[model samples]
Structures are given as structure tokens and as C-alpha cells.
Target: MNDVTQPVSRTVGILAGMGPAAGVDFVRLFVAACESWLREHGHPVLDQSYPEHWMAQLPVPDRTLALSDASAEQPLDAMARGLRQLASLGATAIAIPCNTAHAWHAALQERVPEVELLHIASETATDVERRGLARVALLATEGTYGAGLYGHAFDALGIQCLLPDQAARKRLMQGIYDGVKAGDLALAQQCFTEVGEQLRAQHGDIALVMACTEIPLALPQAPAARGWTLIDPTAILANALARRAYARA
Candidate 1:
């Protein structure tokens, strides 16, 4: 077992670039969280306030295509290589921002057992439990939904995971792929807010799980507008990483 009590001055690995934008957003959140953690604990902001992070922005094959098509190149090898690269750089822990990529998490862990890989969905589910939330809505790619990655994790924690309807799911996908991935923030915001409204109306006070990392980036307004909370897995994962990196100090 790793002694987390030791100083975590070592590098943290970010297994990212599944879609590129989401990966960048995740790292930005991590940086912000580190700054916030230091300030909240009465530590003045300094140049070395944050841990060194190695970003392995793998040009891995498309996760959805790889999952749906039998002949498509599997992303397993590329993802494994990224994890191994991080371990080679002596990363104490790793964070994969993409939810769809998490489908290969177990195999990736097997390839790099020395470091810890943070599970975004599991961390989000844990947050839901801590907040005493019974049910939450999922807004993610079709690949993530089909894999039941978030659903299974939330279920194990006695939380009900609500999914968008077919039409709503399609809208969410448009926001992720055509909007955010394509670098059209305006369109992404439009699609995200519209779909969020639909989900909020249908579910009636249910919190939303931004299972797709890009969703949070594209959100137009916080759920406070609807008197509900939108759970951001990326933010949760980043904050968790910050805490783990500084816990011993």
C-alpha cells in the first residue's frame, strides 16, 4: 500500500485528450482546485503551491467508434501507453477526465499497477452520497450511457441514476460532439441549456450528473436557475486529486 502520509511533491499524471477540450478543462479545474485548497488552509499562494502534473494527451482512437465497430483499432493499447508513460515519469496518481475512456479502466490499471487511477464516476457517486442525494440525472455520450459506467457506480452507492430520454440524449450528444468538440461554445451552450431544461422538467428536482466532462464546459448557467444542482464529475475529480496531493501536509 502506498503511504499517502508522505509528501506528494511528485508529479500527477493526467490521462486525457479523449476529445481534447475536456482534457484541457480538467487540468484547468485541477489547477484552480489546488490554488483554492492552499488558500483555504491558510497557505499563501506560491509558485510551487501546486503539484507537478504530467499530461499524456493521447491521440487515442475514437472511443465510441472503437466500441461500436469490431474492426476499429482498440484504444486499449494507446491508453495503456499513456498510463505507462505517466508511471515512468513517477506520477503518484492519475486522473482520466473522459468518462467513455473509463470503460477500459480495469485493463489500464493492470498495465500500470504502481500508480492510482482516479475513477470519475465513482468519485461523483461518492459525492452524491455525501450530499444526501437520492437520485441524479446523467448527461453523457451514448458510449458512456451504453456502458452503464456511471449507472453502475451510483447504483452500488444506493443512488438512483436517471438518464435522459432518447431525444434528450441526442441533444446532449450534439452538445458534446458537434458543439464542444467542434469548438463552437455558443452552440454547445445552447444545446446544453435546452437539454438541461428538458431533463429538469422531466425529472422534477433531480440533480444532474455531468458525466460527460465537456458538458460542464458548455453549460450556460448553473442549475441554481432551476433550483437544482448540477453535479460536475470533472470538478469533483480535480478537487479530490488536490486533497490527495496535499492531505499529508
Candidate 2:
């Protein structure tokens, strides 16, 4: 038996499955980051040395519907239950890779105040500030756009968030729903690239924030040469979780 007073091992709980694919992708990215971090620090880069984590792929009600329809079942209770499950399993911190789901962040945290809920928007906004990026384009779902979650975070940090106009937003929605979500990677990539190009042309020197978890799956990671920095919120959140999980006293 282990000593109760000994420092507890850090365990990160991943609340995912909003689209299923993004959830799985977030886990893979996190494990890769952990491996990279372990190797760089001269630690054993074996799987056993990596941080303990639980990916709770809950089948919660649709967040977009909950936000848009007044009568639709809210995801708050379901999300809270997922967090409680993680806490019950000894997870110290929780990370949700979905930006749209963060609309209920305040209420979710209120329900599970004992557990740490990492904010993706706030973290990404901080990165924007750190990189001295004054303006950046946002590519996200209609629910996220309506919630203004990213807007509030960026505004708080004095960073300008550029969003898609109505027509562009429609194209983005089709790319995500008809292309990425529908398992047509090629179509999705083409649509995303076109939107990015237009956004870049309209707003020069602006970085593109793949605020939607699905966008990262379709968007090219090496688009820096195209005059736009692609920021993946999943990467940002994953790295943060790794830090908290592997932090040395």
C-alpha cells in the first residue's frame, strides 16, 4: 500500500467526444507531447513514465442545439457527470478540447469547483499575447461564434479576434459538417484552405486560430509559409495538461 501523505500522481481527465474524431485526436496529441517532453528532460521516454490520464468520451447532448434551442436539453448536467466521473477516478485536472462546449464553462466549473477545468480560450488568448499577436482570425462553429466565448477571452487580453463574415462562416460550416465530419478529408482540406486564403488576403499578417477541434484535423500544420500562423487550441490545451501532469516540485 502507498502512503496517503506521499505526493499524489497527477492525472488529467479529457472530456471529449463532441465529434468523436477530435476527442481521439486530442488524446493522441497529448500522449505525443508527453513523450516529447519526457525525452527532452532526460526522463525515461517509456509509456509507463508518461502521465496518467483518462479520456471520458461522453455521449452528451449536442452543445449547438442546447445553445440555440431553448427547449433542447442542456449539456450542463451531462458534462458535470463526466467531470464527476473523472474526479471519482482520481483525476486532478480536467481539460475539454471543444471550444463550443466551453459556453457552459462557468456553470461547469461551478458544479465541479473542486476539480481544475482548464480553459482553452483563455490559454489560447494568453498564447496570442505571449506571441505579440494583435490580430488573429477565428475559425469555429456557429454555436461558438454566437456564444462569443473566444471573443470575450481575446478582448480581455486586448487581442483582436477576426471572425468569418456570414458567407465565409457558411463555407466553414459546410467544410466542417459536410467535409470533415462526413469523412471527406480532401473536401474539408480544400474548403479550409480556401477560407484561410481569403481570410489572409482580407486581413494581412493575421494568424488563424483553429478554435474548432475539427479544424485542426483538416487544416495544414505547415501553412506558416502561406502568410498565416495556424494555432491549434488542442495543442495548446494538451501541452498545458502535460505541464500540470508532469510538473516537478
Candidate 3:
């Protein structure tokens, strides 16, 4: 008789719902990543081959509003509650798909110190560095910019992080709040394309970092976005999460 050993499974948690659409998108990306990981490990792509994962799509306060105004509702307590719930459920690795929500990452990490909380900006920065690109344009919410999430990560690699001018930044914000979050993807397409064009015209054919999870939904196929490389932080983060969840003991 031959002895057989079962493959070990690890749990990955997704703390999402800063906006429902982005959370759903992250799950799709994560599943695709898991399939890729299975193939790389020489395993058949079966449903049982996938890792155990849980998604807590809770309604947290607006991250941008919380960051921009002191009087606005804060997201920390709500976010902390979600993290505790996931941890209690045996999630050993976690990913937060919302970029703006990362402004509270430190506090959240402190809350769940035992879990591996993936950092989207750090993953994106590592991807960018691996591609050997030295300059990239960032498109994100005002809150992400204010927190210097990508900027701090890219700075360590000596990458030049280009940002939109004030007016263009406002346009980006309008696209995020009124367009994607409000279920108006057409408006988001327009706003994001214009900003991409403006940045490309100013900097000339550089890569555009879709730092906000919502930006990729509207910007990827825009005609004006032709001839530019789009760096998707969410996708990079998903890949990172897969690598962590599937690591050999």
C-alpha cells in the first residue's frame, strides 16, 4: 500500500467594501492568481486545489472623507472590527483592496499582528522596480496622495513619482467619488482618460499607476490611454497574497 500526504491549505482574508465593486474585482483577481499559483506548483487546477479564503465586505466609513476632514466620520474603528472578525475566523493572511483605506494600515496591522497584512503600495513598488522603470504617474484619491502611500514606497527605490497638477487632481477625485463610487462608469472613463492624457502630454509616454482600485475599471480601455503602460496595484497585491498563502512550510 502507498501512503499519501494531503496538501495543506491556508486561509486568506479580504477586508474590503470601501466600495463594493472594487472588492468584487479583487476577488476575481485573487482567484485568477490562485489558478496561476496552482499551475506553477505543478498541481491540477481543481476547485480543491485552491486555498481557503474569506471576504468580509463590511460597510466602513469613507476613507477619503476621514482623511481629508477632521470632522468627518472615521474608518478606524469599523476597519478594526472587521480585522478582528477575520482574525478570529482563522485568516492567517489578509489583503485590503481599497488603496485609500491603507492610510489606516499601520493601526490595522497593530491590531492583527499575527496575521500577514499585505501592503498594496509595497507590492506595486516591487513590481515597478522589477520592470526596471524609473518614472511613473500615479492616479489615486486625494486621501492616498495626502498620505503619501506610493510616494513613500517608490522613494526608497529612487523612482520619480509624477502626480497630476491641482486641477487634474480635482478631476481625478471627481472621477472617483462621482463616477465609480456613484455607479457612473461613463463619467469615470471621461475623467480618468482626461487625466491620463494630461499627464502623458506633460511627461510623455510614462507608465500610469492605477493606485486606486476603482481607476482600472474605467481607465484600462479608454482610447486616450493608448501607448501607456498601466500598473495595477490591486493585481500586484493579489499576486503577493497568493504567494504568501501558498508558501511551502
Candidate 4:
């Protein structure tokens, strides 16, 4: 069924507005996942189902924001407010798509303790350990860098998380918010390939967690890797979400 035509159940709360593109990615994943779930279980796919809710009708594809070191809390507040909004609308749980904003998950949880948050970082860490990857490299923003969000989560689960070196980090920061987040696909691919190659040189033979959901828009899963496996948090989270949605269905 097309996204527009799907039957939406209770509203799914999404605390978005971190980097607009990441939020867009999560919604698309949610709808597409629902349909994929439907087909996998032999549920009938509708040719068209008018969305009877707000999130189902958010009319835009690319809502990307340029991120910086300054004012991270604004996005977090946006997330919390959105969660409260969805909860008021009877949403069962809330999911935030941006990895960096996950730094505020604890606070958000405190604000809306009744709403369940699909912890992408926590889930990704578990998956990293489950895959037997002891040491993995991460390519995310400075916020995610300073927060040590993934490292703490992964360490708790017996996995080691590595950050890019200073020089690589500088390039990565420029590459993401400037290049990829700006809708420059060509530039984005350039940035991803550049960062990927740099990471290979600096630290070889490790899984590179595309911690930033926006990173995958640049690095699609087509060309096979020689020494690195791209760990996509979006796909990982999607699988986890699908499992949850199905188990409870």
C-alpha cells in the first residue's frame, strides 16, 4: 500500500526536528516498515488508505537542518514537545530519528515517562555486540562525540566504540551538515567516500557505524567493502521497530 493510502492505527509519536533530514528518514521508514510488516505476515496491502492522523500527513520529504556545536538543547526541547504532543494524541510510544539528539533520551524519558522511546543507540550497541564486533569506528557529529553516548552504551554491552581522529572528525563534520544535510547528493557521495577512505587509512578493518542517520543518504549499500562493513543504525532500528510492531500486533 502507498504511504498515503495506509491505515494508520493509534498515532506514532515522533520527537523530531533535530536535523530535518533525519526526521524525514524516520517517518519514511515507519510507513514503509508498516507495509513490509503487513506483506510479510500476509496482511492485505491497500492500494490507498487515507491517513487519518497528523504524522501521516506531514507534507514534506526533505526537512534537513544544519547542526552546529551551539544550542543543541533547542532540538532536544523540540523533541520533547513533539513527544508530549503525540502522547496527548494517544500515541503509544515515541521515536526520535536523530542519533545526536539521543543524547537527551534520558531527559526526554523523564519528561514523558509514560511514552516508550525506541532507543536507537542502545539497540545499535546491542546489535554491535551481537555481531561480535568488539571494536567499531563511529562517524557522527561533535555532539555525539562529546556526549559519549554510543561509547557508554556499547561499553555497557561489551563492545568498544572508536571516534574518528581530530583531522578526520573535522572533515566529517564539514562533510555531514554542510554537504549531505544540504541536499547535495554528489557532494554527499564525495564526502562519504572521502571519509570512508580516510577512516580506512587511520583505522583499518573495523565496522563503521553510520551513527548519523543522514550519513547513509550519502553512502548507499551498493559497492561491497574490502575491509569495512557499514553498520546502518536506520536499518538496525527499522528491524527492531518492525519486530516490536509485529510482536505486539
The models' CA-based lDDT, in order, is 0.83, 0.85, 0.90, 0.68
For residues 96-204, write the lDDT of model 3, one tens digit per residue: 9999999989999998898888899989998999999999999999999999999999999899999999999999999998999899989999999999999888998
TM, every model = 0.91, 0.91, 0.96, 0.80
Better of 2 and 4 by TM-score: 2
Worst 10 residues of 2 by lDDT: 1-10
Candidate 2 stretches greater than 4 Å from native: 1-8, 221-227
Worst 10 residues of 4 by lDDT: 57-66
For residues 1-249, could you state the per-residue lDDT of candidate 1 as single tens digits? 433432345578899997788888888999899888877877667765678788878798988777778699899999998888888987878999898988888888888889988898889999999999998888889889988899899999999888888988888888888888898878788888887788878878778888888888868353433555778899999998877677653
User: In TM-score terms, which candidate is top?
Assistant: 3
lDDT of 4 at 193: 67
Q: Write the per-residue lDDT of candidate 4 for residues 26-100, one digit (tens) a residue.
A: 777766776787776656776442122234222222222213435332455556667777788876666667787
lDDT of 3: 0.90
Can you give the lDDT of residue 67 in candidate 2?
88
Off by over 4 Å in 3: 1-7
Clashes of 2: 0
List clash counts for every candidate, in order. Answer: 0, 0, 0, 6
**At residue 60, what lDDT does model 2 achieve?**
82
Considering TM-score, which of the candidate structures 1 and 3 is the better prediction for this target?
3
